[model samples]
Target: MSDKPNDLQKIRSVADYQFGKGVGEKLFPGGVKIVHSKRTGRIRHVYLEEKRLATLRPTNGLFSLNIAGAKRIMKHVKPQRLWVRVREEAEPFVARGKSVFAKHVIDADEEIRPQEEVTVTNEKGKVLAVGRAMLSGKEMKAFKRGVAVRVRRGVAEEVKKETLTLV
Candidate 1:
């Protein structure tokens, strides 16, 4: 909203808890804008000038990270939380927005819990998709018959952001 300082701090705290330390400051850097709901006066979205970064869920006080936000966070943070590494063979398919399966997951953050948001990446750590984890990291690596991450956005679609405007 108009008063970005307080809002930024709150969001930063959430990001740091959900992702990892320093990720909050990286995601919502200086000069970024926070959009709030007029009716609720709660943060609804965030942007960096023309690019949409994330959506803030007031109910849960959690952020639903967009592809751009994921990329930004991944770039700056190491040993990132909520990330799953898929094998090379699954790279193209994951980049196309397909769900990641347990068989294809090479590694994952051991702290990842089911139903949490996660970023799917290749072995090289390049982000392929942003999604929700359907299984825990332990299960993803230990099992071979279930979906791991339910992808919400893919790398290919991120390229289309330039053609679209944040609303």
Candidate 2:
């Protein structure tokens, strides 16, 4: 509790490990608050002002990225990794939090593994959702009928909610 710097370092290291090199510093900049669990005293959530960036999962010790976190990766990380690009026909459905079918996939990072965190994007590389990969990236490209990514949060849902708030 006394060492905010240490906590930040720890989370940054985790992010780098889970995502890619140098991602920790880019994703989590200075002045971010790291929230710890009350029961276990481990890193739980990371935030900047009011918006959450990521949640450190206790089960896997990896990150479950929020929309902001996903965008950060897309924006800051070059040669984007862990992303599944879907066809235009499925964009609206996928953007609304629907699971991605392998048939709809146009491309994907071949490095992606099953159950790993991934970003679902449009052909133009706009991130539409964040999700857990149900299939390996190779499998996603080869197959045509099964689910590829189980979307956890969709940009459309978030945009709709935010739009309501603004109205």
Top candidate on TM-score is 2
lDDT of 2 by residue, 34-81 (tens): 899999999999998767899999998999998989999999999889
| Candidates' RMSD to native | 3.4, 2.3
The number of clashing residue pairs in each candidate reads 0, 0
Show where candidate 2 strays beyond 4 Å. Answer: 1-5, 163-167
Instruction: Provide TM-scores for the models.
Output: 0.87, 0.92
- Per residue, candidate 1 scores C-alpha lDDT tens digits across 1-167 of 57556987988888888887888899999878989999988889999876778898777888888888988888887767788999999898888788998999999999999989898989998889899999999999999988999998888777766547453
Residue 102, candidate 1: Cα error in Å is: 0.9
